[model samples]
Target: MSFPQLLTPEEKLAQGKTALGIRDVVVLCGSMRFAADMAEVAIQESVAGALVLKPDCNMKIAHPLWADPVEAEALKVRLDDQHKQKIRLADRVIVVGDYIGDSTRGEIAYARELGKPIRFTDPEVDPGEPGGDPAAEETAR
Candidate 1:
């Protein structure tokens, strides 16, 4: 049996459709510690036809002032605000890990406050399936 080939994000967006037909914008929220995982999820979502947005994890090294704790914290707050704005522009928010860190939790709460739907990538859940705890799905909406 021949299986269908998956399309790249560019191809998917070019087609203007997805398996779920949810081609709206999505904001990916996760800890900087899981930057790679966040990027993977962003790519997957983008391929699945969502316009995915993620923080620039490379900003720390690009800005030398962020090496200082005070400066880093201030920059973090500014970045977090920018992410919240992205969430405001998104149709939904996808948290990228099984464990929610402090920052991720804050982003989730902010997304909830703005009435955006939330989804999570839980290891216990099948990756091939629409994932996230049902309780969280209910609460996010």
Candidate 2:
């Protein structure tokens, strides 16, 4: 018979928080172009007593670490998957930007699919909100 696998570090952390009754876990999702703005929101979330998780790097900026084309593409894929994992670990998701690109839009859809509560820094861009444009949701779907 197959038994359960060990919890990952992220899972362990989440379990620990739940055991400790620390429920405010927020994940930030948006384009890397608004990385700075997301950082500010992270600070605000932290101050508001949330355990905030966000993009650790802005890969759009030129960097020696991701200088190679193949490496950079692979890293981008890895980072996107990691962010999805963060979303899974989070209790809530926050989209932090005025513009909603394909990636961010996909994140929003995924959050919605998972039944996680989502808030937008720019409410106008929230596709689920009134007057949020059906076109965007169509494109996202």
Candidate 3:
């Protein structure tokens, strides 16, 4: 008697999504300054029949909850971790802005490590592509 082969993490995620009747899982990554751009991309992804995941909060927004420097820093760390989880779960990543900040760059790297396909709203800013500048920030805008 032989045991079945164990599934890879990507395979496991695909199986789970299939069990849930999800066709495609797309995660959006970008600077919080382009939250509006991300929102637009989310809508487009949804309309295209993808299950979209994105940052749910814009910490840059003036909020009493995160007004304290220490508290805001802690929240930022937690949020970044959560976004990485989203990238792990997603089958693909869509970067939703012309700008790629440090946080977004990290997310893109994580997604690449997971072998997830990545697309950019502004293709010129895609670090994985030819002539794409990883250090570029807000230059395309």
TM-score of each: 0.66, 0.78, 0.86
How far off is residue 52 in model 1, in Å?
0.7
Off by over 4 Å in 2: 1-16, 129-141
Tens-place lDDT per residue, model 2, 54-127, is 98978989999899999999999999899999898888888888999988888888877765778778878876
Which residues of candidate 3, in runs, are more than 4 Å off?
129-141
Candidate 1 clash pair list: none
Runs of candidate 1 with Cα error greater than 4 angstroms are 1-23, 58-65, 123-141
18-68 per-residue lDDT for model 3 (tens digits): 998988888989998898888988988799888899999888788997999
lDDT assessment of candidate 1: 0.71
Error of 2 at 73 (Å): 0.6
Model 1: per-residue lDDT, tens digit, 16-102?
Answer: 645656458888887676788988888887777778888885553656768888888888789888888888767787777666767
Total clashes in model 2, counting residue pairs 3 or more apart in sequence or in different chains: 0
The weakest ten consecutive residues by lDDT in model 2 span 132-141
Output the worst ten-in-a-row residue range by lDDT, candidate 1. 123-132
For model 1 the TM-score comes to 0.66
Ranking by lDDT: 2, 3, 1
